[model samples]
Target: MGDLLTFKAGKVRYDETTKRATPLAGKGLVTVAHHEEDATFVSLVWERRGPGAVDSHDGSEETEREELLLFPGDAQWVHCKKCTTGRVFALKFKSSGDRLLFWLQEDNGQAEPGTLSAADNEISAVLNSLLNVLEENDGNDIVMEDKTGENTAALEDTLSTTNTGISIPILSITDALPISSFVAHIRSLPEQALKPYYDLMPETFEHTRENLIKVIQTPQFFSSVDTLSSVFRDSAGIGSLVASQLGYPYQGEGIEGFLNGARESGLRESENDRVAKDQEDVMEE
Candidate 1:
């Protein structure tokens, strides 16, 4: 075991073992342990269950109880065998060479940068597409971080407002969709219904309108939107059919609603305003 951290009563405390904190609070504990020199030949088996126990290469079920070493202030991402995906512990060695031991830290497990799940990827795409739509129309509008309930309605209201240089600070849309209503909507759907859209835009549910607006201002943004929309259109079937399958229910093509909303939101109108109409056509098909 490298190290463990526990939380108790809104406060974080450290300990070597559970016993040490038993007299007090065992909310969090970090254990530093390593195998002996003779056990160097032991195989490290990575498992999803429990602390990583040392095992013999001979396929022996017996787990070796390694000695816990003490040193240093704290451990960072020291590189372990199990730092593959998601949030992971950052570990460091207490000493080099024969004195090689390990320390572990509780991390969100994002060791690799730009790492995202399928859901995250799609949300980013939608946000990016919306950004392109916003940027094509020259204005001082900024994306806002809001989602659901009064906030969602507020966004609709703001988009419909007659203001110039409006900024929507949707810094929390993605994180906030887990409220009861949203969860209920998601749960009501068949797993397959959301797959196509999710596959196309893996991170849609995790986006903030603010970040979405920012990305569209990048170079050749319209082209990017066209490309993304084209893919959805060409793929057709479950691909372009995402409006009903994934997003909130609406009449006709939802792209029209988005365009009309964008227009009313006071963002600049595109020279080729037909782009929105074209996207609406894609959605209709």
Candidate 2:
């Protein structure tokens, strides 16, 4: 709720093919703010201008704007690109220290990564504070609500109305098997079968097979699977697969049936219009 944190702008080079960034020259102003209703989310805004362009200069207004929204446990490195100028900038957040890393790439394709330290004490302090808040609530649910009395709805009501379902067939299969049996079956699968999952995860695949099995066997993990399966069922495109595998194919009206129904309704409406016109002609006689 206090003053926003701002830092000087720096030169950034970005590679389209690799989606990486390298830091280049002078510093510019960057601003950071936390969402008023959601403490777990933060917003960062920055601008980059042509070389030697001052705030009061003619070309100063031509500065390119970039904005980013970050949540707890986001990936360490993120990049932003400017479509008009083809300029790319990258930021890497480190929780261990009071610094924000910047990167840009040179014309020759070498990456130059630079660190913005505590010399800008105000910005550094703000960044550190935001990181600390996120670390404190890393795996917890973040509920955003207005503190004022205007929002009186209960959390349950809000969740019920806003939640959408997307199903995961693999997770749903766990419902039919005993927990121990399910865990054993998953652990017995070939490493190749799990590679797709590990690749999708943000962290590197460093855990041993036994350790991974132990991690997934916990009640907390099962609860998360259930919640995710309930929230994302239809949107995940696994509903049909789930129904077919469970021996209960979906019988609801599909797109083709809905189109045929619409066609019949339109035909009836046209017939009624013709009958009304005939009645009007007879009345005129």
Candidate 3:
């Protein structure tokens, strides 16, 4: 136990039924003295300065009185469970921080209810300090008790999976095409690659091209392009539309000839070079 800590009480009252001291009327001083053996028992004393003299008498002539509001080992130290009709006295020492009922009575009849409270920050600090000392002397580690009553085993299972890195994997759009390969392909395309399409729809192509350039300059554009390319590759109707727009027959012998021409072009070598460069850059990174 440490030295007694005192605080100025802003209000004091008295519970008629419980017959316990309460703060009401005007402010007063409160002091708390700790018990050496019993951690729960504490002594509380209150001192109230009387009103100043109104006559020619000096204000210093007014008498101040001290009251032993609570004593060591008082029954008020233990909360009453059944009482419901008296002033409620409470003190919280844990993170719960809720007021714990310290005094109560079965009934108050017609007696007006009363309350006592000290709002000074120093008072709260002293209370907390007292709790800390008691916990230390009792050789107990203070822990935050879980009040939610959740399943502990389920929580532990979730935490275990997180710690072991066994969570589900997330796939992004770039998984469809390597970003580096997509960037290289765009860079290799001729500036007039869309000329045929533009010739077919001049105004529409102009707007589309402008929008495409803006989108391609952004860092995430490669991933979006990869997703769109995947969709086009998987859709036969889209491929036919592309062939027809480029002035090549969409099917039959013309399709075979167009395929043959594409294979014979030097595109394969350029693609291989791009792949190799992408791999080299990845390794350097």
Per-candidate count of clashing residue pairs (backbone under 3 Å): 33, 20, 6
Q: Give stretches of model 2 more than 4 Å off.
A: 16-27, 36-40, 49-63, 73-126, 133-238, 241-285
Q: Cα deviation in Å at residue 206, candidate 2?
A: 41
Best by TM-score: 2
Worst 10 residues of 1 by lDDT: 147-156
Tell me the spans in candidate 1 whose CA falls farther than 4 Å from its real position: 1-4, 7-57, 62-64, 73-83, 86-90, 98-285
lDDT digits (tens) for residues 1-285 of candidate 3:
664776543222222233333223333455677644344545455455455321211222212443222222112221111222223334422211112222222233434333222332234445545444321121111111121112111111110122376654223333333433344465566767745433543242233443343234333444455455555545556646665666544442223333433444446557888999999999999
Q: Write the per-residue lDDT of candidate 1 for residues 180-214, one digit (tens) a residue.
A: 22334544666565554344332532343222322
lDDT for model 3 comes to: 0.37
Model 1 residue 200 lDDT? 39
lDDT of candidates 1 onward, in order: 0.28, 0.41, 0.37
Task: Name the candidate that leads on lDDT.
Answer: 2
True-structure Cα RMSD, model 2: 21.4
Residue 285 CA error for candidate 1 (Å)?
A: 98
